[model samples]
Target: MAGYSARVRGDIGRWQQAGLIDASTADLLRRDVEVNARQSLSFGSILAMMAALLFGAAILIFVAANWEAIPRLARVAALFAVILGGYVGGAVLKTRDHAAIGEALWIVAAAAFGGSIALIGQMYHLSGDEASALVTWGAGTALAAVALRSNPLTVAAVGIADAWLFLKGFDYYSRSDFPHVFVVMAIVLFVLSFWTRSQPARHLIILSLLFYLVLLATDQATLPVAIPLVVASVVLFAAGVLVPERVDRIVRLGGRLPLHALLGFLTGLAVIQFELADEHTYNSGFTLASVVALAGIVAAIVFAGRESRGLRWLAYLGFAFELATIYVVTLQSMLDTAGFFLAAAVLLGILAIVIIRVEKRMKDPATGGATA
Candidate 1:
């Protein structure tokens, strides 16, 4: 397949030579391998994007150098001209099949739109409401992305909208307006994710929703906040296990949301642990809650480690921190502390061995013992 790495191709060829797979099967496998790897931008595309950034920076510098000399009308005209030129050039290049360049130009156009909004506001001596300006700019970019069906532009729009929400949320913490706005924006972006079928956009939308949840947590009681997060994490992980294909159809996230939820749950548990430790009581309800949370986190780590390497690492890190913190808070004598660490080290070594064996078994059940 065009997208297959050399090592993968070699393996396929060897399988074909060994008659494990027929030529027709090999061809079908190759055909099934999608060619467009969108996880990273191509080198040329990255260079084009960098070039666009530098060009935009140069234009800004030029305008700043002649700020006082240039008439206000001329300045406004120049700004609009740059914005118009970027969109027109991008459209033309896209039609001509220069997709990378066109994408870069569209990014430039989006940036120019933001700059124009700020400049126009300054020219009119408008009152400073940066949040409103960001919202307007985001709306414009979203419209452009919808019209052009541009993934990069959609990403830009989401980022702008996120910034606006963050600022507005901070500014109106007691009003409950920003949260509603964030919810609406999140819904719009979710729909856009399905329409555009952009993985990056979908991930961004998920992150935005997570951020909104965090913001809401800031207003509620800490224990209540932790409870919901823990519950949501468990539910999300269970959903991933039970209906992964359906989850992928709805979100196109490929089991990542469960991992993210797991991380969030662990983080919330950590926060609760620290909050309890701050109470400085050895036999209080907080202490008991902390212990329960720790055990739950450990169980989650063990369960997730069986399937996901990333989640396994996160679990390891979280468990290590929790164990260290618990020992520091609960142990008094230096000898006892040192013994605790020694026991922990031994347990971790055993865990590593078990994990390696599990991985080997998962990779090749028939030869698991031989491989180990």
Candidate 2:
């Protein structure tokens, strides 16, 4: 098969030589395999995309440079013309099977939408509220994405929404409570990801939600902040583990929920470690919480590590960091430098053995002991 590796091809060649399969059959198998393999952009497609971006940038810069020279009415007309022309041309190209170029034209159209908003605001001498502009642009782009069913446009919409949220929170509502707008927009993008089946859109939604949570955490005091974060992380991780495939199908995350949950859990643990390790006096309550969190993290590693390589490595890093922090903060004097190194060596050696066993258990038999 065309998609098969060289090793596989070599085996197939051997089989053909041994008269196990005829030439025609081997060719057919290769054709079928190639057809089923994932399609990737050719070098020509990449070049076209690069050219499109440069062309779009040039058009924008040229228009901006001569913007004041053109009449106000003509400026508005030109902006709308570009937007309309881009969409029309893209549709025609798409129908003609020039998909890569058509997609590029659609991106140009989306960019024109933002440019039109800025131009209209300038023409009217409107207030320079970036958040409002971003919200408007994001909404418009989202509408276009829905109409066109374009993933690139959806990505643009997500970017605009994320920017709007960040600016709105920092500049306009720093002292206010959490921005519910972010939650609403994130939910919209989450739905769009499923509708569009776009992994980037889903990842963007995850990032925005995480940013919102971090902002909320930073708004509170240390211990109070740490508790809710830990609880939320635990809940997220639990849901990822317990939620069924049917639910994931409805959600259409492509199995990314568990990865996000793991990240959140690790983040919460890191925050707790920092809080407990920074305190001069080792309070009994803080120590207890730290121990519980650490144990939970280890348990998570043991339970989820085999299935998720990212989680496995992240957990190992977190565990090692926590141990180092604890030793530095509480046991530096009790255990001399040599003793600390000795303890670390022994602990790490045991951990290595355990990890190897787990990896072996999780290895796939069909793949001749290849790891999952």
Candidate 3:
């Protein structure tokens, strides 16, 4: 984050010097960078956080090891003490300018909160599933994050929410409420990313959402699943890429969301291709998926390559995966694969022209051009 911040600041400086942005605007951008950027975790600070995690793990182990010998009330008190001490000490340290370590302590506290929930549930013989317990822990940690404005806690909450989804044990075909609850949890974490200013959490949430969509496609009928994914992803791509000014007024993550949206679009197309393959429409399906994947790779580069290296890397990785899978899937029919690429090349040229025009419009101030 430090390196990113410095690079952004330098770009803003050059932009201002080149008369692209006024001084006041540049100052506002700098302040926004300072307030919203995640504090970089230095090597020593990372080690300190690791140490804190180890200490917390040891505490949990010792408590569990002596569970029968320790009185029930003492056990509860000990867990609460650790939780309370972590939070209090973290707040104190942050006030003393130990921000990184303080955030790490918050993570430790969140871990304790989650463990305490599970341990207490087991101790009391509570009648609830792991999913419910996880949701409770996630909710508690998210509230703590909101109260403390802690990014680490925000990340922990997102992880817990994802774990709840995976550990729910709900059948894919069952009309279970757990999946819906998980979506709610993911949405809440996405909203909190803005308040906590945690880009990593936001990035994780985006990927998790896409993963959830893919899971849906696998769990349900492909046509029904693909429709929703394509529609929703198109909307997201429009919001995040086509209208940056409007998206900036709402949520901002340095233009990464657009690439995620594009990924979702590709995933939806891939799902359809597989569905068609099952119906013995392999060649047509492969053509559709291949052409779209190629266009998606190009769009990602055009939209995000200039400003976001991470997004560019992910886009390339995703394209590479698609190509590799296509090759393996069509190994017995190399000539058929060649035909798909030939068709894709023609379609890509047309798509490239449209993308170039869009880029031109974006750079034209009269066309409501807005730069991030």
Per-prediction TM-score to the true structure, in the order listed: 0.81, 0.75, 0.77
Q: In model 2, which runs have C-alpha deviations exceeding 4 angstroms?
A: 1-54, 172-178, 221-229, 242-244, 275-277, 284-297, 320-372
Candidate rank order under lDDT:
3, 1, 2
Worst 10 residues of 2 by lDDT: 363-372
RMSD of each: 4.1, 5.3, 6.2
Between candidates 1 and 2, the TM-score winner: 1
Per-residue alpha-carbon lDDT of candidate 1 for residues 260-332, written as tens digits (9 for 90 to 100): 7677777666656666776756547556655766676666655665567677667667666765676666654
Q: For model 1, what is the alpha-carbon lDDT of residue 44?
A: 81
Give per-residue CA lDDT, model 3, range 110-214, as digits (tens): 888888988998899998777778889989999999999888788888988888766553452344643756677788888988898887888888777777777
Candidate 3: worst-modelled 10 consecutive residues by lDDT: 169-178
For each candidate, the alpha-carbon lDDT, in order, equals 0.73, 0.72, 0.76
Question: Which candidate has the highest TM-score of all?
Answer: 1
Q: Arrange candidates by TM-score, highest first: which order?
A: 1, 3, 2
Candidate 2 residue-wise lDDT at 137: 87
